[model samples]
Target: MSPRKPDADVPPGLLLVDKAPGMTSHDVVARARRVLSVRKVGHAGTLDPMATGLLILGVGAATRLLGLVGGHDKTYEATIRLGQTTVTDDREGETLTTTSAAGIDDDAVRAALAAQTGPLQQVPSSVSAVKVAGRRSYDRVRAGETVELAPRSVTVHRLEVRGITRPTPDLVDVDVTVDCTAGTYIRAIARDAGAALGVGGHLTALRRTASGPFDVTRAAPVEEAAAALAAGGGPGVLPLTEAAATVFPVRAVSTEEATALAYGQRITATGIAGPHAAVDPAGRLVALVEDAGATARVAVGFPPAS
Candidate 1:
């Protein structure tokens, strides 16, 4: 047998994927592992099988950074159906109840949605991936475990109703754009809005629009990644330094400072409060630096000569 090439020692970087609906998050990672040809692949957040849109995967050393990004804010475009309740809080679940939403005029819909725009305590869907005493809530529920998730503080930075349609007295479909914190369930938003209006609710469709600065437009499908890798071009993975420069505050370091970092030493200071990306003379992202008390050194290590 041919010797297998070693998995990359250094984390490669982030691959922004435009995940298609119908596959679990783990499935995306498995495909990425083949295309990127590295075992250190990981993703920042989970998207439901029925939801499509941007998914950010970390390659190599970038896996270490997933935890940081996972907890950041996210955005979505979702369709909420009022006048119906579902077992999973979404269209895929069995219908549990239905109430005619004919009395819910647009003015009342707007008011209820507006009330939830800022910070709110939200109860997650019972079938969520959240853990209950070490078991996945979804798993427990499927096994006949009654699930009840408590309310948590979550911020909805923005929620805009794009359009509303009521094709039947028993169904009210509202398309909305939502920018919210991580762990905020859009399904719950639909469910609660209906409950608030004495109707019923569940999410019918969902598409993640953005996560942090990453968005759907920049996401590459697994097929695209595979084609890129097949020609030896590699999966257009974003180099950490370049990715950092694109995403973080750019601090131009002097020749001396860059050299100090390249050599594992510290320069006086960039005079810039960081969590900042530092670039070399060639415009190569070298490190992410912060002022840790007295010295300015690398907080994230990007191999200097690679």
Candidate 2:
């Protein structure tokens, strides 16, 4: 049976979970619902059971904000172990093969990583949640069906090499900071990087450094997140308005503009062009809008606005 609710006194919002290794992202969400005692819960993105890092969770009405969360860029710090291949594209898989990447120099390795540092196409690891023909890739893998996910374009703003360690003549660890679009798979980066170096590689450690404005600094471990809620503690998981404010291009809305949006009407273009975040005089975020049809129309809304 699942655990009972405990944080009955806490207000609902997002929880930045610094997920520990070995627990599935779903496990974290389940634990969080019990810890926060919220009737509604959801996770913004899925992290593999073996990987750990910042996992954003929505409590109560914040669940509606998941799609919004998806729009923001994400960052990660990961360690890829070179000279080996894995069925899972990660260390959790069976060791498929091994080779000595001993001759690969730091310059060549950096060049390989740098080659992937900009906007490029990326393929997800086979053992992933991506769906094909309306079925999850992992589900197919579980049922003994061969799965191959096609490459998709993803923007990689940065791929800073943090370090590299050679534990053995064959085993090497490369650390990287990834600032990229939402769908880029770090595991794929590892796989491709290894392929480039003439040696296979797989991810051994993963830590999401940031998602939009939320960083590791805002994240807490499962226990700590629970304790904070249980103690009648912590800040409102950045209300919808505030959370939206962090990413959207800012716009100021007049009373007329606010009224139009409040009544589900689009406002006229006041020579202000944007796919912008419109905030009321009260600091409540009103809508995300695009300058279309000669008016700044609401592309998305945030009412009960923060």
What lDDT score belongs to each candidate, Candidate 1 first? 0.81, 0.80
Q: Give the Å error, residue 18, model 1.
A: 1.1
Writing each residue's lDDT as its tens digit, candidate 2 over 9-109 gives: 45445677899998998888888877667657788878888877888887655576677786678898999898999988898999998989999889988
Q: All predictions: root-mean-square deviation over Cα?
A: 2.8, 3.7
Per-residue alpha-carbon lDDT of candidate 1 for residues 1-306, written as tens digits (9 for 90 to 100): 999898644445677788898989999999978765678778888998989988888776667567766877899999999899999999889999989999899888878887778899998898999999999999999999899988999999999999999989767899899999998999999989988988889999999978887777877786575345434344445666666765678888877777778777876666678577878778877677887667777787566544
Backbone clashes under 3 angstroms, per model:
2, 0
> Candidate 1 — number of clashing residue pairs?
2
lDDT of 2 at 146: 90
Model 1: how large is the Cα RMSD against the reference?
Answer: 2.8
Each candidate structure's TM-score, on Cα atoms with residue i matched to residue i, is: 0.89, 0.83
- Which pairs of residues collide in model 2? none
